[model samples]
Target: MHVVVVTKNTPDTAATVTVKGDGTIDWGDSLVVNPWDEYAITEAVLLKEAHSGKATVLTVGTDEHQEALKHGLAIGCDQAIRVWDGALDGCDSLGYAEAVAAAIRKLGDVDLVIFGRELADIATDQHVYQVARKLGWTMLGYVAKIQALDVAARSITVNRLTEYGTQTVRSTLPAVISVVKDINEPKYPTFIGIRKAAKAEIPVWSAADLGLDAAALQPRTQQLRYQELPKREGTVEIIEGATAQEKAAKLIDRLIEEKVL
Candidate 1:
């Protein structure tokens, strides 16, 4: 299958992510793989098992992103690759699409590219469509299940979730697909796998390696500014009464006095 899955390191779902007073995001020390990408990695591994092919996971970021690649390696990906450059700072979805599309092209023989529905950190999924567009490949988003794969015919049939309902459609191979967590339960990395991934050497590709220049890394979309809203303050009151009826009466009276009744 030679499936290539994209993943990212993001704040842990349970972490309290907030914008600091300096305008930078504070994710604390807890970071993990994008929760949605778990299913994507699992799907890649499953595809490799079913088709006796390789599953390679790729990402774009700094050294901090290696954690995500290691997780993919532990999850059964045959290889892990990362791309980044100083110039890529402040890069938006369009710039990422440029880098990712170029990297995929450099690989030359990727049959399928998969992704999580969205990135947890960015809370946006535009890169998925942008990457597909840059590659001029068919994009199947919100895939619930991969129904069939015909390597001989170079076709794939998948059941994808639509706003209307689940719809099954077939498309040619060498395409892009975005999956949801419901597609499959991701397997936890085993002790052996974790140790191996910890030792695995992941190659980092630079913008030049992907034939990208500083101009390409420039963000097409800009975020002018953002400010956190002040926290609203409130107080809690305990209503006390000797009986339920008394309590109800008091609650009603309070509500009427507060003009909320």
Candidate 2:
């Protein structure tokens, strides 16, 4: 049972983010593991321990991404891997999927891969599904619970939370699943775990190491610029009436005048 959890560093929820005058984003001073990913990390660590298997947590980025890897390590992931390359600097989600799929292939025999339903910073789950597509593996999303996982039989059963309702799904191993935040309570790092994680050696996988072409890693989508949202301009007016019925009538008339009736 080899569980691979993919995670990344994101700005802390409480941090203030501002788009700079130069079209760059200033993410502030604090970076933490994606809040939603903490649940996936916890689930991966638990799965590894229950099956007595290896749990490897990985990310795609530079040193900043080590923040997430160490967080997973401190939470009990057996090993940490960082996938990166200079050629991947401005890549989009498609490029990210390629790199992640390559890394998973290099680690061969990975029974299951887990990811958070969405990234806090980027607010998208495209990379998760894209990686599964690139790997030609089952892709499950919004998993509220992993009901069962049998490494020997190469099978998994989970409860999916969707807009309609929860559905029970069974899939073969070597699949990729994105767990929702409610799946489990993410445990904080113990003092000893932190100490050990800080001392752990994490290897970085470059594009060449993953047998990827530099040109293929180029961005598919180009961002023209990031401009701040237009300032909201409006005025509030309180409807005044001597009676409730009168106020209701006035409100209706106002709605009709505004074409909102």
Worst 10 residues of 1 by lDDT: 223-232
Positional deviation of 73 in candidate 1, in angstroms? 0.6
Judge candidate 2 at residue 27 and give its lDDT: 80
Candidate 2 weakest lDDT stretch, 10 residues: 218-227
lDDT of each: 0.91, 0.92
Predicted structure 1, TM vs. truth: 0.87
Clash count, candidate 1: 0
Instruction: Give a tens-digit lDDT track for model 1, residues 2-115.
Output: 899999899888876667777776668687999999999999999998999999999989888899899999979999999988878899998999999999999998999999
Candidate 1, pairs of clashing residues = none
Native-referenced Cα lDDT, model 2: 0.92
Question: Which candidate gets the maximum lDDT versus the true structure?
Answer: 2
Residue ranges of candidate 1 with Cα displaced over 4 Å: 224-226, 229-261
